[model samples]
Target: MVSSYPVQFDVDFPARPLDRLTTAFRIIVAIPIVFLLAALTNDTVQGDHHSTFTFASGAGLLFVPLLLMILFRQKYPRWWFDWNINLLRFSNRVTAY
Candidate 1:
């Protein structure tokens, strides 16, 4: 008796490993600094602690995901790459590639 079957193949794509620590460090450090500067400017203009706190809180909220991504980056490279690629792709403003 002979049996015939179609063969299935899986292709593995090459990917570069990103440094989670660096990504996290940038996100954690840079975002807040930028936000803080903006908030300081607002404070200088309006002279209100409430606005400064609001901006700081918002910045902290934004920072959380970046911190998490950095912490678990190795576990989700595809997600990370997709996110970064999409951002870069969109930022270029040219759809054609």
Candidate 2:
């Protein structure tokens, strides 16, 4: 029997041949995007002497809140779901690249 899932994902293959140079150097090309994703998500930088903490304002998903809500109230807010899904999509895209 067919089933309807709450969420689904798909990616289409490229019609044209993949660029050999880009394919070979994908890691180099993806460096910036990976860093961007890291900054968006939870990323920390440390120094030897003075420890400075940096966080992008309102950057990460509502993980703790969502977990608490699910555990205590058995609820998942729509807004939080949207935020998490979008962030996940960005992370996946960066990783796939």
Candidate 3:
């Protein structure tokens, strides 16, 4: 007699050979993308000679503006709300990559 498990998994091996060169250099190829992800998330990139650059610095999630609008206008703008929500979603998706 045999007992059955609740869950089962199976995977087939690939027929084609894997690219060893690309796999070996994967980390080096991904360096620019890593920097891009960091910049999109409001990270500062510092360079030599006391130089520093920031990308999308002004594109931070809406906060102060939303607060001021909520306080004065007593309502949140649909576009602003959408912008903030989509920004977060986009960041999450990009980071997942």
Runs in model 2 lying further than 4 Å from the true structure:
1-11, 43-77
Candidate 3 lDDT by residue in tens digits, 1-93:
444987765667789897989678977876787766565567667999889986554456555777889999998899977866977876775
Candidate 3 TM-score versus the reference: 0.43
Off by over 4 Å in 3: 1-56, 59-62
Specify the poorest-scoring 10-residue window by lDDT in model 1: 36-45
Q: Residue 60, candidate 2: how far off, in angstroms?
A: 5.3
**lDDT of model 2 at residue 86?**
96
lDDT string for model 2 (1-97, tens) is: 4559877767899899888887879888788988777767876778777896766535545567678888998887888778779989998878776
Q: Please give each candidate's TM-score.
A: 0.26, 0.49, 0.43
Reference-based lDDT, each prediction: 0.52, 0.76, 0.72
lDDT score of residue 85 within candidate 2: 95
Candidate 3 residue pairs in clash (backbone atoms < 3 Å): none
Best by lDDT: 2
Q: Is candidate 1 or candidate 2 better by TM-score?
A: 2
Evaluate model 2: give its lDDT.
0.76
Off by over 4 Å in 1: 1-62, 72-76, 94-97
